[model samples]
Target: MCGIFAYLNYNVQKERRYILEVLFNGLRRLEYRGYDSSGICIDSDLSQPSIALDPAENGLADGSCKPLVFRQEGKILSLVRSVYDEADSTNLNLEASFSVHAGIAHTRWATHGVPSPRNSHPQSSGVGNEFLVVHNGIITNYEVLKETLIRHGFNFESDTDTEVIPKLAKFVFDEAKTEKGEQTVTFSQVVLEVMRHLEGAYALIFKSPHYPNELIACKRGSPLLLGVKELSEDANGGTSFHDSKFPTMDGQPKELFFSSDANALIEHTKKVLVIEDDEVVHLKDGSVSILKFDYNKAKNHGGLPRPASVQRALSVLEMEVEQIKKGNYEHFMQKEIHEQPESLTTTMRGRLICGDSSKAKSVLLGGLKDHLKTIRRSRRIVFIGCGTSYNAALAARPFLEELSGVPVTMELASDLLDRQGPIYREDTAVFVSQSGETADTLLALQYALENGALCVGITNTVGSAIARNTHCGVHINAGCEIGVASTKAYTSQIAVMAMMALAIGDDTISSQARREAVIDGLFGLPNKVREVLKLDDEMKDLAKLLMDEQSLLMFGRGYNYATALEGALKVKEVALMHSEGILAGEMKHGPLALVDETLPIIVIATHDACFSKQQSVIQQLHARKGRLIVMCSKGEGPLVCSNGSCRVIEVPQVEDCLQPVVNIVPLQLLSYHLTVLRGYNVDQPRNLAKSVTTQ
Candidate 1:
C-alpha cells in the first residue's frame, strides 16, 4: 500500500536540489498507490552539514555526518515544503553537489501506526540513527523483534513496524563486527542477517553511514525493481541492454533508481530488473550485484546466508510516461472510465478472429494456448481475486462454464486462504488482479501452488509477482490504471476472461454458432461502449439528483449481477455512499425492506437471459413505491419502467454474456460524478490503496 523510491549515482555528480527533485517526483508518480505521509533521506554534504547533530543523538559513534532526513505527516507536497522551509531557515545551499550520493524516499500508507511524522518512513535506528530504511509491506513478527530489540536497550521513536528494520540492521551490523573482530562487515552482510529474522512481505531500501556510497535494496513477497541508467556512451547509445547480459562492473557514470512501482522508474529509465522474492540487490561503485536468500545456506550460517551473486536479465518497461497521465480528464478515475472503449479494444486486439468467410470465427489467446489442453482436462476451474478483479471474474464465470463445460468456482483470495480450501492437481486456479501484486491473491496463489494445482494469472501489470509465478496467463493490456477505484482494468479483465472461455470452448460443434455470435459481440463491444458513453451527461444529471441520498441499492441477475455489484462498489468506494448490490431473486429475502421512496435503488433491467426476473424485480420495487433507477437496454426502458416514474439509464445492448461490459459504463460515469459532487477524492479515495499489497 506504500510507495518506495531511492536514487543513487556513481561517478556522476548531482546537486542536492536535483536529487531531492528526483526523489520527490518519484514519490509523486506513485501517489496512486495511496499514502497518508511522506519522508526522504539523502546524503548530507560532509564538508558543510545541513543539520547539526550530537554524535550520540545521531547514532554516529565515529562522529560521521548524519544523513539529511525530512518527514511530513501529509502529502508529498508537504514534505517538499518542509525540506525547502528548512533549507531557507538554515541558509542551506541545496545547490551543493555530490559526486557519489544516495537517497531514499517513501510515501507511507499507515499500517503499524497512525499517520504522523513520527510514523512516516525513512525510519531510523535508535543508537546513532546509523541505518535508515524505507519499507513497503507489513512486518508480521515485528512485535517479537521489537521486544528483542527493546531488551537489547534499543529505544524506538515511532510506533511503526518499519522502525524495527533499521534497528534490526544496526543490531545485526554490530554483532557481525563483533564476530569478525577487525574484518570488515559489509552492508549487504548486515542486511542479509536482518532478513533472516524478518517475517512478512516487504520491499526495503537500506542506507547507512556505516557503509557510505552504497544502497542495498531487497524484497520478499513485495514488488521492487531497479532502473539502470548507464552513461558509458556505448555503441548502442545506452538505450537498451543486451539480451540476458549483465552490465559490467567497470567504473562508469551511472545512476540507479529503485521503486516499488514501475511508474516511478519508467520516466528515468526503461531498462530495469524486477527484483524477485527473497532477492537482495546491492548497488555500489556504478555496479549492481544481486544476492538470493537461500534457506539451506542461512540455516548453516546461523540464519544468515553467505554472499552469493545471482544473474537476472534487465527487462524493457513497455509503458510510456503519457499512459499514466490524466490528460484532459479531471481525475485518473474519470480518464480511465472514459478510456474503457479503447481499453476493451486493446484487450481484444489480435485475439478475436471474425473469420472473413472461410476461417470460422475463433478466439486465440497466445498465453493460454499451450495450457488450454490441461485446463480442459481439469476437474474444475477456480477464479481467485479481490475487489474489482473478483467482480470481473464473477461477470465472466457463467459464460466460461457454458463454453468450457467445466464447473467454475469464484473465490475471494482472502476467504480461500482462511479456509485453506482444497485445491487438487486436477484443478486449475486462475488469479486475477490489476496490479498482480495483491498480497492476498499472491498468498492464495502460493497455497494453490503447494496443492499442485496449475496456476494462471490475469493481470494488467506485466512484471508483477502473479504474472511471473503463474504457469501461463493473459495480460489485460488495459494500460495503466492510476485510480484506487478500477474502471478500465475491470472491463478489460472480463474481456480477457471471456476470450479465455472462447478458447476453451472452441472444440464444441454445437456451440460453434454461439461462439461466433460472442466473437461478433466481442468485436462490436467497443463500439457499444462508445455508444453508451454518450449517456455520461445523463448519468451526471442522475448523480446530481441523488447526490444527497444516504444510500444506494442495485439489483440484477445472470451476467449483469456482477455489474450490479461492481456498480455499487464504485459508489461506495468513490462516492462515499452506502451502497449494496442485490441479486434480483434474493431481493424479497431481505434487500427489498431497504427500499422506499427516499432510498435510491438501481436495477439492471438490461435485456439478457435474466431480463424477466429483473423485470419482476422492477415491478416489485414499483409496488413498494421504491425510488428506482433502472439501467435498461436502449429503447426498452418503457418495458421495465411502464409507470414512467423510475429514472432510466439506457445503454446499448450486446450479447447477453457481454452485456456487463456495456452495462457498467453508465454506472461508472454516475459514480464518478457522484464522487465529485460529494467532494471526495475521485482517484485516491479515502483510506484505500490502488494495489492491496497487504492483508
Candidate 2:
C-alpha cells in the first residue's frame, strides 16, 4: 500500500542535486501504487552542520548534523517543491558532493493516522533525530511498543506506526551500548533487536548519523529488493553480476538501490536480489551482507543468537522500462485496456497447440505438468484470491468444473481466514493474484500450508512471494500492469485457467470435441478481443450518456456473471460511482425494487448458454420502464431487446466460456471514460492502493 526507494553510492562522488533527483524519480515511478503523501531523507554535510539542533537534546556536544528530511501531505511533486523552497530560502548549497552517502524515500498510503506532514514517513526518534526510518506495511504491535517507549521518555512527533520504529532503535542502541560498550554493538545487531519486538508486515530502511556511510534494510510479509550496479574491472561491463554468487564484482558493490518494486529500480539496474522474509540486508563501505533473523531464538529470548549470514542470487529483470510508459494512450488504464489483444496472445504463447492436418489439439502448462495427476485426483479444487483476481476465477469456475470433473469452489481470502475454512489434504488450492504479494492471500497460503493442502499459485509477477512459496504455479505473462485498476491481467488470468482446465480434462474421451472447440476458441480468442476493443468510441459515447448518473446496475448469469461483477467494481472504484452487480435469477427477489426509469442498468445478454434466460431478464426489466443498456452479440440485439427504446451495445461473440474475456473489454473502456468525464484520477482513484498489502 506504500512505496519505498533508497539509494546508496560508494567510492563515487555525486552532487546533492543529482542524489535528490534520483530519489524523487524513483518515487515518481511508483506513484501508480497510490499514496496520499511523499517524503525523503538524505545526509547533510556533516562538516558544516547546516541544520540547527536543540541544545538540550543534541547528543553531540558540538551540535552535530541531522539528516535533511522533506515531507509533504500530497503528491511527490509537492515534496520536491518543498525541498527546493527550503534550499532557496536558506541559501543552502545544492552542489555539495559526497563520495559515500545513503538516502531513503517513501510514498505513504495512510493506515495509522490522517494524511498530513506530521503523519508522513521519514519518521525520526526525537528532537535529536538520532534514527530516521522509511517504512512500508502495517506494524501490528506498534501501540504496545509506543506506550513502552513513551514510558522511557521518548517523545514522538509523528502519529504513524513508523515513528515507533526509529524510537525503538534508539532505545535498543542505548541499552546495548551501556551494557557492551559502544564499539561492541553493530547497526545490524540493533536492527535485529528492534525486529524481535515487531509483529506484522513491514519493509524498513534505516539510516543514522551514528552509523554513517552505512544502510540497513529488513522485510517480513512485505516486498523488497536490492538493485546492484557494479563499476569494478572484473564486472565484464555490468553483465557479469548475473553469474556471480553475490551482487558484487570483487567482494564489493559500487552502488546499491533498494525499492519495494522492481519498477522503481528498472531504470537504474536490471540485476536485483529479492529480499526474502526475515532477511536483514546491510550495506557497508562498498559491499553488501545478508543476515537471516532467527525467529526461533527470538521467541525464547535465549540471549538472542547472532543473525546467520545468507547468500542470495541476483536475477535479471525481464521487463523493459518502455512497457510501463503510456506511449500514445492518455492514461495507463486506457493503454492497458487496448493492450488486451497482445496480452492474451502472450498468455497463451507456447501453451495452446491448435490441431492441424498432422496432429491433434493440445494444451501444455509445464509448471503444472508434473502435478497434473495429483490435481486430477484431488477431492476438490478451491480458487482463492481477492478483487479482480477473484472475479477471474469466478469467470473460469463453471468450465473448470465441467471439464475437470472436480467440485470447484470460490473463497475470498479474507473471509476464508475469518472462518478458518476447512482445507483438506486431498484438496488442490489455487491462489491467484496479479502482484502475487497480496497480504491476505499470503496469510491464507500459510494457513493452507499448515493444513497440508496442495497449494498452487497463478500470478503475473515472476519473483513474488506466492511464486517463491507455492509448490507449483503459472505465470500469466501479462507484462507490467501500471494502472491501479487491472485490465489485461483479468483476461490473461481467465485464459490461463481455461488452459489449465483443458490440460486436466485431456484424458476423457467424451469431451474430446468440446476440448478441441475450446482450443480453437483459444487460438481465435485474441482476435475476438481485438474486435471487441473497436467498441471503445461506442463505450465512450455511452459513458457520456450516463456520466451524470449517481448509480449504475448490471445483471448477468452463468459465465458472464463475473463480467457483471468486475464491470461494477471498475465503475465503483475508479469512476467514483455507486454500482452493484446482481444475478439475473435473483432480480425478482430483491434487486427488482431498485429498478426504475431514472436509474441506468446494464444487462449482459450476450450469446451464451444463458442467452435465453438473459433475454427473459431484459424483457422483465423493460416491462418496468427501466433505463436499459443491453450488451449483446452483433446480430442478437433485436432478439435480446425487442423494443427500440433500450440502448444496445454490440460485442463480438466468442465461445461461452471465453466470452467474459471479451465482455469485460467494453466495460473497462466505459469505466475509463466515465472516470475522466467525472474529473477523477483514472489510474489512481481516491483511497485505493493498487496492491492491498494491509488488512
Candidate 3:
C-alpha cells in the first residue's frame, strides 16, 4: 500500500511551493496504506547528462555502500529501520520540489521490493539520474526481468518490482536511441514502450528527460487521479489555485496533482478525474489526455475494470475505504483496526453532532423524519443482511429499538429466505451490505419489498442493486473494500446503523449542532484511530497467548453481540481454526458445557449498557477454569473476576452502538496477528479473493 503524487508545469515559483504543500498533505491523508519509507524526485538541480552515451561507457559508481545502489536483506521493515528517514518517513525535506517542470513523489509500503532508497520509486538513470518516477501495487514478476537485465549488462540497483520500471524505461529509450533518432520520439513514448514489456499490476507517475514538459502517468488495476486546478499568486506570498479552480467556478487549472486516490488530490484541488485500468495520462499545461498501450502483448485483457472518473473531494464517507487497506500500517487488517476510532467518529458525526453525556433524549431523524415517524407507528422493524453485514445488523438491533422507541428485529438473509417466513406489510426493513450487490441480501431485500415493507439499504457501494432497490436509505460511504473477510466495511456498516438510529430518534436538532458535532468528529477521528493503533502491542500479546488454542468462544451483549460473531468469523477466515460467537445468555444453555481450561473464551465487555451482564458471563467462564480474554472500555478496570483468572484488552471509549466501531478492531487484529504468527498468508487466505463476484 503506497500513495503517489506528481506536480507538473509551473509558470510561477510560488506555485511550486503550494504544489508541494498540497501534494504532501494529500499523501499524508492516504498514509493508511502501509509504507516504511517515502520520497519524491524531480529534475535534479545537480543533474547532468551522461558523457558516454554508448554501452561501453564506464567509470560509474555501482555497488553496495556506494551513493547509487541500494542493498537490503531480511524483512522489509528491518531493512527500512537501517536507512529510513524518521522525520520524513524516508522522504526527506518533503518541501523540496526540484526546479524541473515535472516531479514524482512516493510513500512506500513496499511489497515486491525491499524498503530502501534504491528500491524506492522515482528511480532514475544517466550520469546525474535526474529523471524520476513513483509507483504503487505489485509488479508480480521481477526476478525474471532482473535476471534478463543482469545478462544484458544492466547494472542492477535495488531488488524491487519498482526498479524494473525505471531500469526498463531507460533501457528501452537507450536501445531506441541507437536505431531511431532520439528527436523522433519523446521520453513519454519510451516509457509506454517500456510498459509494453511489463506484467502484473501498477499505477505510476513519472517524468523523463526526453519530455521535460509533461508528467507521465499510467494505471493498471490500481487507482490514480489527475486533479486539475488554476493558480493565483498569493497576497502574502503563498500561492493559491486561481479563482476558476475554486468552487465559484470550474475548469480553471491546467496545473494539477496526480495520485492513486482522492486524499492526495483533495488538499490540492477537490476537482479530480480518476484514472482507469491500462489508461495512460499525460498531464501538463492544465489538461489530461488518456492513452492506451498498443505495444503491450495483452492489449485486449478483459480482467481490467471500467475506468474511474474525476470526481469532487470526498469526506469521511469515502475515507473509510481509503484508510482501511493502504494506510501507513503493515497490513489492511492493521489499518482497519486502527481505523475503528475514526470509523466510530464518522458513524456518530452526522447525527449526534451536538449531544453530550445526556444524549438529547432521542435521535434527530431529519431526511428520514417522515418515514421514521411512519415506522414508529408500525408494530416492528426487520433488519436484513448477510455475512458480516448480518453481524452488524445483529449488533444494532437493541440500539435502534431503544433509541427510536421502535421495535427492531434482525436476521441473516440466507437464513431468512430458506428457514422461515419473513415479516410482512407496513414493516420497515434495513438491508446492510458493504457491496450492495450481495446476492443473498439482494434477494432478501426483494422479498421484503414484495411483502410491502418500506425497504432501506445501508450500504457502502453507491449504485449497487440494493441501493437501487431501496426506496430511501443511507450510504455508509465506506468506499472500496479490498478484503474478503470484511474489516472496515463491517464497522462502517455498524456506524451507519448507529447514525441512522440517532437520526430516526427524532428530528429537532439545529443544523449548527449537527455540523459542530459531526464535522469535528470527522476531523478528530485520525487521532482516535491513532489511539487504537497503540493497542497493537496488546492485541499481539493476546494473540500469542491464544495461538495454540483449538477453539475460541466469543461472547458479547447488546451492540457487541454481533461484534462477538464478527470477531469469531475473522479468526476462522484468516486463522483457519474453529471459533464461534454466541450471545452471553445463550452460553448458559449450551456453550457453558464446553468451558474448561483448554478452551479460550473471548468476551466483548466494552463499557456500555450490557457490561455488567457480560461480566457475569466472564465470571462463570473463569469459575469453570476457562481461559478468559476480555475487550473492554479503557479504565474502569480491576477486571479480575471473583475466581481471579482472566485477561482483558481495553479499547478507547465510544457510544454504545458506536462501540462496535472500536470494539471489533482488537478482534480483527487478534485474528491477523495469530495468522501471521503461525506463518499463514494473511493477504490471500486459502480460497479467498479480495472480491467474491461468483456464485
Query: Against the unseen true structure, what C-alpha lDDT does each candidate score?
Result: 0.88, 0.89, 0.63
Model 3, CA-based lDDT:
0.63
lDDT of 2 by residue, 1-695 (tens): 79999999887678989999999999988887647999999877654343323323445313334578889999888999999999899777789998888999999889988999989988988765678899989999999999999898888777788999999988887776567644356889889989999989999999887777678999998889999887644535442232354666354536699998998888888889999999999998877889999776786775434867887889989988888789999999999999999999999999998768887799999999999999999999999999999999999999999999999999999999999999999999999999999999999999999999999999998889999999999999999888999999999999999999999999999998899999999999999999988888898899899899999999999999999999999999899999998989899999999989999999999988888899889888889999999999998877877768899999988888999999999999999999999999998899998888877
Worst window of 10 by summed lDDT in candidate 3: 59-68
Shift in Å, residue 134, candidate 2: 1.1
Q: Residue 571 CA error for candidate 3 (Å)?
A: 12
Q: Please, what are the lDDT tens digits per residue for candidate 3 over residues 29-121?
A: 444343455665533223333344454562221220111222233223332344334424545443545322565666666565556666665
Residue 300 lDDT in model 1? 61
Off by over 4 Å in 2: 48-57, 60-65, 233-245, 249-253, 355-358
Q: Candidate 2: lDDT of 296?
A: 64
Candidate 1's TM-score reads 0.96
Clashing pairs in 2: none
TM-score of each: 0.96, 0.96, 0.54
Candidate 1 deviant stretches above 4 angstroms: 47-65, 233-245
Q: Total clashes, candidate 1?
A: 2
